[model samples]
Target chain A: EDQVTQSPEALRLQEGESSSLNCSYTVSGLRGLFWYRQDPGKGPEFLFTLYSAGEEKEKERLKATLTKKESFLHITAPKPEDSATYLCAAAGASNDYKLSFGAGTTVTVRA
Target chain B: GAGVSQSPSNKVTEKGKDVELRCDPISGHTALYWYRQSLGQGLEFLIYFQGNSAPDKSGLPSDRFSAERTGGSVSTLTIQRTQQEDSAVYLCAGRGGQGRSGANVLTFGAGSRLTVL
Candidate 1:
């Protein structure tokens, strides 16, 4: 079974603080790795999709990097609005799009 | 219309009652997905529908959980004889693309919060 594990279950940071969340995985064959941001009471919003090692993608204050065994989401100078649970998922070798997700890291940015 | 939408934002039901949740994907989207989120658990994939083909229901936990997509646009998930463990937020998403690598980003709905007592 493909498995995803995220570190630092909860993170608290002051406004403008920078930190990184980690997502490690083990799968038979990796088709894609995905990053999503979810707010309380809402569904997850897609952030980035990394297909190979050394691949990186960026948004306003977030950067996602993927390697053979893991993916990382780095938040730079985060604001209160940036606070949300970060989710990481891995799609296996099969054509099916079933994604195995990690428990997620809850981030709270204080103003 | 613009994004994936789910109906009945909140549902409170008796433990033995059945509940049906609905999802309306963005117009023209070819793929639809269902997931459940418990208090501390991560998002759990429940089922997936693509075009007019058979759905992938491997993620469903039991026979009590079933879903159907109609007209390739609207989908419904029906849970029979709900249990306390069934209390969670159910989310839906839509995707479009010919392949996994080319699949468009998934757009998610606000989710339906189901509380069984």
Candidate 2:
């Protein structure tokens, strides 16, 4: 079975603070690792997709990197608008279709 | 529609009652997925339909929960004898294809919040 685990269930940071979220996974024949951001009362929004170790993708204030056994989402100088739940998921080649997700890390950035 | 659309944005039901949730995927998308999200929990895969191929129902929690896709676009999830534990936000998403590029990204709907009492 594919398992995805995230650390630091909740994070509190002042505006402009930078930190990173971790996602550990054990997937058979890993295919892709995904990141998503979700706000209260809203569905998650797609963020990035990492296909292999050492691969990285970035957006406005978020950068996602993947390794052999884990992935990291680095937030650079986060703002209040960046407060949201960060979710990580992994899809394996064996099941090519199913995605296993983590509990998620809820970020609260206060300005 | 511009993106994945789910019906009955909010629902309140009693135990033992059956409820049906609907999903209308994006145009020309061949892959559709249904997931359940409980408070403070990760998304739980429910089912997925890819084109004309057989759907993957392995993620379904139980036999009471069933889903079907019609014409390879819209989908309906039916939960019979709903239980309190079944209360959650039901999310529907669609992927254009299996490619690693844009086609692989899943576009999600606002989700249908189901509350069973």
Candidate 3:
């Protein structure tokens, strides 16, 4: 069975602190890995998609890197406004397009 | 361009009542998806519609959940005999069907929050 697991269920960081969240997966074939940020009362917002090992993408203080069995979302100098639940999902080779998502890591930045 | 849109941002209904949630995908996006998110939980895939072909309903939790896409544009998800456990945020997303960029990034809507009393 394909599964995704994220580490550090919750993290409290002071403003300007940098950290990384981990997402590990077990699947037959990895088609894509996705990262999303979700705020309260809203749907998730797309962040990045990594297709192959060693692939990396970035957007405004957030960087996503992928490997053969896992992915990492690194936040640089995170601010209070950047606090949100970060989710990681993986799609398999079957083209089912059904993303198996991790439970997500909740980050709270204290000012 | 307008992103995916869902109707009735919030809904509250009594148990055993039926409810219908609507999704309007971005114009020209042929791939639409539905998911459910319980409080503080990750997304649970509900269904996927690719063009006019039959949808993939494998992820639906029960037979009481059904969805249909009309004209390859708007889609509706209907839950029959709602239960208290059915309460969740229903999210809709859309992507270009084929020949798009790698992996076809999904655009999501604000979602509809359902509460069963």
Model 1 chain A: ten consecutive residues of lowest lDDT: A91-100
Q: Write the per-residue lDDT of candidate 2 for residues A45-70, one digit (tens) a residue.
A: 99998989999999999999999999
Top-TM-score candidate index: 2
What are the candidates' interface root-mean-square deviations? 1.9, 2.7, 2.2
Quick one: ranking by TM-score, best first? 2, 1, 3
Clashing pairs in 3: none
Angstrom error at residue A105, model 1: 0.6
**C-alpha lDDT of all candidate models, in order:** 0.89, 0.91, 0.88
Per-residue lDDT for B53-80 in model 3, tens only? 6458788999999899999999999999
Q: How many steric clashes between backbone atoms does each model show? A: 0, 0, 0
lDDT score of model 2?
0.91
Which 10-residue window of candidate 3 chain A scores lowest in summed lDDT?
A91-100
Candidate 1 DockQ score? 0.67
Off by over 4 Å in 3: B97-102
Question: Per-residue lDDT of B1-117 in model 2, one digit per residue for the tens?
Answer: 798889999999999999999999899888889999999899999888887454588889999999988898898999999999999999998887567632257888989999999
lDDT per residue (tens digit) for residues A1-111 in model 1: 889999989999999999999999997778889999999888899999888899999999999999899999999999999999999988877643778889999999999
